[model samples]
Target: MRILLVGEYSRLHNSLKEGLEALQHEVTIIGTGDNFKKYPVDYCIFPKYFLQNRILILLNKILFRIFKLDLQLAEKGIRFWLFLPKLKNYDVVQLINSNAIETYPFFSKYLLKKLFNQNKKSFLLVCGEDTPIIDFMLKDQLKYSILTPYLNDSNLKSEYWFSLKYVQKNYRDLFNFISLNVSQLIVSDLDYKIPLPEKILIPNPVNTNKISFDNLVISEKIIIFIGINKSSYIKKGTHFFEKALAIIAQKYSDKIEIISVENIPYNEYINLYNKAHILLDQLYSYDQGYNALEAMAKGKVVFTGAETEFIDYYNLTEKVCINAIPDVDYLVRELSLLIENPEEIIAMGKRARLFIKKEHDYINIAQKYMDVWNRN
Candidate 1:
């Protein structure tokens, strides 16, 4: 099958592409490299002129301030429009999200309509923030979510505008348009699956072959690593992790080594966390995101979303990763438990690697995707 995957999220599409290609299907991914993470894509629609030029960057800021217009998104739209000719005639086209290109809703809808008209089958992947996910959060369906921080403190509204914008009419229309165009809506993980229960639940794909697992050896100090993306600090409940780390650091200064970084590239981020025994991932997630899944594959015990829903679905008896929440005390306690009993960390790390191999192997996930796409 000739598959075209639109957009990238934490290398999810890239890994899927690898799996699909391994299974003898031709796959192409077009995306903007997901900002600073720089996930590879066959076609990169990043706004080089606006991003690289200092004058244009300043002008973009001014335009956004005065006219509430993001020139970067417009640039991305133009690039995608130019690439539309080569993007057609695919056996199946799957969007990474409703706002896959991260462009204005109206323009995104226009571009998506073209792809749908040209492609044989269209499908939508619910992996990231979109209208339905935002709507579900607004209804307070979950006990706690990424929006918990912003809901508790309205001052963080600015930080959450990227997600909150989906609730607007234009985005809602975009969602409706995509819904009508796509044959099926496939969710990536429990976070999206719980909100849209009827959608096909496909787990995120991780290339276990590329990620090697090493049995964690704790000699003197347990290294705890946390990478923060400042833009998503509030939305990801990173502040909770920060507070918890602070407490943990003060208590176990000699027993543990805390490594914290902000907004690094994906390669560097992975390499830096490779030595760590524990990786502090996002809070308020019901399932592990790509970063956490990759970390788990690397045999790093990650503090990410591993809720009961995830456990029950996986039918696990042992703890693979920590279920992070928006509570500093809870996070600190979880960290303390690991610190006090280093063997648990080693045990969990092994379980995490096995879990990824068992559930998230890229080849198996790609086959599941192929089955779904073919069935639809």
Candidate 2:
């Protein structure tokens, strides 16, 4: 079957493309390399450096307000319009999100109309914050959510206010348009799945072949790595992790080495943490996000979201992952325990790789997508 995956964020679609191709299915991915992360795609829509460069970006902004035209949007609109003729009669077309093209509502609706008409089947992934997800989160329904940090701190609101406002008003038409047209709504992680209970729950696809597992034997100081994207620090509960790390480092400065890398490129980010004994990932997430999953596949002991629902779903008795919550005291204690027993860290890392192999094997997850697409 021929599959056209629209947009790329979090490298989810890339992994899905790999899995689909491995099963002898034709697949193509169109994306902008997910902004700064620079994940690869078959067809690239990322703009030139002038549009992204600081000085030139300011000039583009000035031009945008004067002419009521955004150069980035203009480029994407033309490119996608020209590409539309080639997109028809696919077995399936999956959108990375409702606003996959990152265009205004009018254009988003136009693109959705064309996509729905062109493809045999259309599906939307509820991976990021969309109208429905935001609406659901506003209700405070979840036991704990990524919004917890933002809700508690007004200072953080400034960073996410534009996104919050968009979902509240500007995005409704496009959201409804896609929801009505798509064959199904699919969610890979519990964060999305919780708010969208009716959507199909498909495990995230991770290409295990791409990640290598090397068990490091620690006789001296154990290295713990944490990478922070400044924009997401508060939302991801990085402060909690940082506080815990501070305490842990102070107590076991001789036995533990804490490495924190900030806002690096995707490949470099992965390479930097490759030698670490433990990887500290997001704390407030309800599931292990793409980064944590990738690390786990590489046999790194990842401290990620292993909430109650996640543990119960897998029937996991052994701690395959260290569940890092939004509590500094809890984090400090867990890190301290692991530092004292280096052998247990090795054991947990081994289990982490096994859990990912069993639950998130790319081919198997891709088969699930095929099953759903074929059925619909």
Candidate 3:
């Protein structure tokens, strides 16, 4: 099958491409490398000059402020329009999200219509923030979600603009357009799945072959690592992790080492966390994200979302990873348990690797995607 995956998210599409190619399918990915993480893509529409040049970037910001025009998004749209001919004629085309091209809603709709018309099948992946998920949150459907912090404190409104924008008329219209064009909607994880209950749920793919599991050896201090993306700091509930870490530092200064980093490239981020015994991931997730899954595949005990729903879905789980919440006390307690019982850390790390192999193996996940695409 000839597959065209539009946009990249936390290396999900790249890993899926690898698996599909291994199964003798031709796959092409076009995206902006997901910002600073820099995930690879076959056709990159990244606004390099606009993003890299200081003057241009300043001008772009000023233009947005004055005229509500984003130069970078415009550049991306133009680039994607130029690449439309080559992007067509695929057996299947899957969008990473509603705003896969990261352009204005009207421009995105226009470009997507062209791609959808040319492709044999069109599917939308609900892996991140979109109109439906935002709507679900706004209605207070979930017990708690990524929007919890923002709901509690309206002062964080600025931080949530990206997500809140999905509730606006323009974005809602874009969502309706995509929904009408696409064959079906697919979700990547429980976070997205919970909101869009009717959509097909497919777990994120992880290339276990590339990520080798190393048995954790903790002879002295238990190192804890956390990587933060400034843009998502509030949405991801990173402050809760920070507060928990601070308390852990004071109590277990001699027993543990805390490493915190912000806004680093994907490769560097992974390499830096390799030595740590524990990796602190996002708090608002109900299932593991790409970062946590990759770390789990590497036999590192990760503090991430392993909620009851996730555990029940995977059944007979022996603590594959820690379930992180927004409470600082809970986080500190979980950390203390792991620190006090280092053997469980090694045990959980082993379980985490096995869990990834069983539940998120790239080849298996890719095959699942193929089945869904073919069935619909």
Candidate 4:
């Protein structure tokens, strides 16, 4: 079947496209131009630079005040017709609606409704609880696809209300709309009162193609976690890992080296992972991020989160990646053990790799998508 995927945030479409094509299905990916690199498939480009879309939207808002034109409505009106011809042509089209301000086209409920009405058979793929218009656009859907983890699942959601203040009210309203409209909700198995169309637990997809653990020669070196940014502590557990590192590094300073090249470009990172024997994933959030998964693929043992659900998902009671707070004392003890027993560490790393291959390997996950699409 010919499929068109729209939006390119989180690089998910690329992974999905790669997986589907491997499954012998035709997939076409489209996204904003200029920001993307050479992807596996030539994606659709809706050209809008930072200055162009933001400035245009702001100008329209100013115009709204002068002419009393429902500027938001007016812009939505123009884009609906402008984009419909291109959008309505797909057999299955996935709209990647982001919560960011720039995703105006994806946010237009009326446009999506019109397109869906025009073509009733198109399988609408909506990801995350983002977009203020999801419920309105997909109010009749008997199901939902929720990818992002629960808002309160991590400690970071304490700022959710504050973050909501910046988004336009209508946009924020969409979260509740999705809650009301969805018949089934797809999400991680976390303890949260998220309203669901029906609760479906689908863990995040792990890309095993980029990750590997075939032939690893252990090196006596410590590698700081990659893919961690300023928010790593809050979202991916940067601080927690760092604190544990402080404890672990005290005795192993001469034996194990720690380096955090979080800002390294994508390709270079894998090479670094190849060199390191261990990867510190996250101290705060859920177990093994995509970064942790990548490290495991490179044959690095990760020491990070082990949330109750994640522990159950993998049945990992003996934390290979010791999940502990920044208590230097605790992390130091855990690291000492790993550095002392390299074989055990490698064994755990192998387990990590196996878990990723069995669960997140995008190829298998993509096949699952096809199976879902071609159901009885």
Report the candidate with higher TM-score, 1 versus 2: 1
- TM-score of each candidate structure, all chains considered together: 0.98, 0.94, 0.98, 0.68
The per-candidate count of clashes, in order, stands at: 0, 0, 0, 13
- Order by lDDT, highest first: 1, 3, 2, 4
Off by over 4 Å in 1: none
Better of 3 and 4 by TM-score: 3
Candidate 3 residue-wise lDDT, 176-210, digit = tens: 99999989999999998888888889999999999
Candidate 4 lDDT score at position 206: 62
Candidate 4 lDDT for residue 144: 19
RMSD after Cα superposition, model 4: 7.2
Best of the two (1, 2) by lDDT: 1
Model 3: per-residue Cα lDDT at residue 293: 97
Please estimate how well model 3 matches the true structure, expressed as its whole-model Cα lDDT: 0.92
When summed lDDT is taken over every stretch of 10 residues in candidate 3, the lowest stretch is 137-146
List the candidate 3 regions with Cα displacement exceeding 4 Å. none
Model 2 TM-score is 0.94
**For model 4, how does the per-residue alpha-carbon lDDT over 1-376 read when each residue is reduced to its tens digit?**
7666655545567777878778777777655421323233353343333224888768766776797544543443454357567555555555544321133433545554565555423332344334432332233221211112223254535534323322546565544443343223334223211223344444446667655556445564644443465533353445656766776667667777776765544556566667677776655434444455556656567765555656776676555455544445666677788788877777877776776677677787777655554541
